[model samples]
Target: MTVESPAAAHARGAAVIGPIHAPKASEIFADLLRQKILDGEFPEGQPLPSERSLGEQSRLSRAAVREAIGILKQQGLIVSKPGRNGGSIVTRPTSQELVASLQTYVRSQGWGADNRTLLEMREIIEPWCAAFAASHRTDEDLQRIRQRLDQASASIDRVEEYVSAGLSWHAAVADAGHNVLLSAFMSAASTPFLSAADHGRYDSLKARKSTLKTHKAITAAISDRDPQRAFDLMARHVQGSEAPLLENLATTLENDTAATG
Candidate 1:
């Protein structure tokens, strides 16, 4: 038998190890760029470096750099438009985006929290959101909230319109809370919660009237800048609105109201 050469043996051994690709170069580059964007190295509305520059820094092919940039755009970190004036531009992270993300996350959790549990969680934080709104809201916030409330009040007979107005009012109150985290939470929760409460028809006629009354009371409390009253009104309004859905809880609330009365 012929003896194999040392070089031949080494070559055969290297072939056995395959191509040695750990991960995609584009993925690594994207990760590095993501950190930079999150770290504010690329501020909102600022243009990102050209693909050529990124390619050189990353020691990657132009195609790989493009892939990385595409990942950033997908993440909503950067936007790219084709044209003379368009390239990769960093995005301003909005509360709306945060809320949308939160909504997606909650949905993904599936059984993590049922509607009742989710509503309860909302109830815990929302009263405080109203109280804060009372002390912190600006004239702009007041105007926005009042406009939506007016629309809701006027649309009592119209289901879709009423739902739309109710959503707007919830969003306005969330904005009025003046806390980014709380605003985002409420914004995310508003659609699902109200949609569930309405059960497809938006709101029952009786429910709509009660909702209008309760909302107006809460708005008045906030407008008057009465934090304690705002909190109380909001709590009462939530308990009342959630009653039909959670019959036993509503019954308990009614019993308490009667006992107190």
Candidate 2:
């Protein structure tokens, strides 16, 4: 008796496989809608086709169309409202929620979203954000940024107020770049760190002054439309901010431990 490997048998035309069956109508319809939505045919906050119309167009039962819509909803592609003047509307998913989801996934994989990771992310992203804003920003964008800066400067000596203003300043820079996803990522990468530093670390006048100086420098670079300077200043600023933040975290933890002990 002779035996041959499956690969050899297939090459000798002794084995064959049939084509895969077509996907169900519900899936196919879902895919079509998904593609169009992803392609921006369905702009955010706009209504999708009515259920009756969709079913008619797809030539599928209402049940199948409903299933297809359910799939899209699960993927966060659409928001549905059922009432007078309410329907399924395309959604503009923000980076905050998306980044949060990804962070959760990272945690599930055993990577903690810690201070070190947050600082590293800022080191990587803040410079790029500053540079992009320098290149892409308009006069109106500059005005928006200046307003945040003014707000921060006015409350520089106030702890919580300063923190809120400073966060707004960073958000302005992110928005000036006109990249929504990057804006969201900057928020995600910095929020925990800023919250910790603001509440526990930045009590010193020196730290506040240093932060204000660096912020001014970064803003000046962007105002001058100097991308390279913007990048360099932001990199320097984020790096400089890390040490104080770590100290702040340590002090807060030590205080808690002492109280408990």
Candidate 3:
């Protein structure tokens, strides 16, 4: 073979040495695309670039571009269709999807203690919601609250039924605040606490009666449009009942740890 020029030799040597060991182009592309979706640069229902075009634009192989699209699909950020003009399309993230992801992450990390912390947060935030409901409630709102209270009072003979009704009453108060975002947040935050409370000593006769008394007081304050009184009653109701419930949970956990260890 004829001797190669210096530039040709350098090219041969570089080829033998293999391509530069840079980061995976697919990962970089994926990250860039993900950011675009999150920032609303690629809005929901908008079709993404074709795989071949995206590959050329990003200076990556078609395989890299396709892999990035796969990642976005898995993340609930995009959906893919296969046909003529088929491509990935961005989708709006749903609250249920986000909540499921969060619950999975929290459960994987053994976040029971964090659930307790959320209960503490509810004690503060929910009272404010109740106060807001009290101040802003219309006659129609009062009627709804009264209806829930009536259902709860009727179920007082059965602890489980009563507790379920009681939780509904609080949920109604949150809804009556006329703030959908706050209502959604409180609903998510209280889910774990309500489950725990359902199985706790709050199921006892004396506890049921005490809870009914507190609920009545809170309802009365809300009905009378007494925001300060509603706030105070809610605060005391949470502190008095939640502290004992938590103490019960702590004792149970200690016993469980001792047995398991």
lDDT of each: 0.79, 0.80, 0.76
Ranking by TM-score: 1, 3, 2
lDDT of 1: 0.79
Better of 1 and 3 by TM-score: 1
Clashes within 3 Å, all models in order: 0, 0, 0
Please provide, for model 1 over 56-99, each residue's C-alpha lDDT reduced to its tens digit, 9 standing for 90 to 100: 87789999999988887777788877899888998866666788
The TM-score of predicted model 3 comes to 0.64
The parts of candidate 1 lying over 4 Å away from their true place are 1-23, 43-46, 81-86, 103-114, 193-205, 241-261
Worst lDDT window (10 residues) for model 2? 105-114
**Per-residue accuracy of model 2 over 1-261 as CA lDDT, tens digit each:** 886767787898886664589898889998999999889888878899899999888789999999998888877888898899888988866566686765555445553334566666777788888999999999999898888888888988887778777877887898899898888776655455454555544678778777888888888999999999999898878777356455667998999999999
State the weakest 10-residue window (summed lDDT) of model 1: 194-203
> Cα RMSD to native, each candidate?
10.3, 11.0, 10.8
**Which residue pairs collide, candidate 3?**
none
Model 2 CA deviation exceeding 4 Å by range: 1-32, 39-67, 74-76, 79-114, 197-201, 241-261
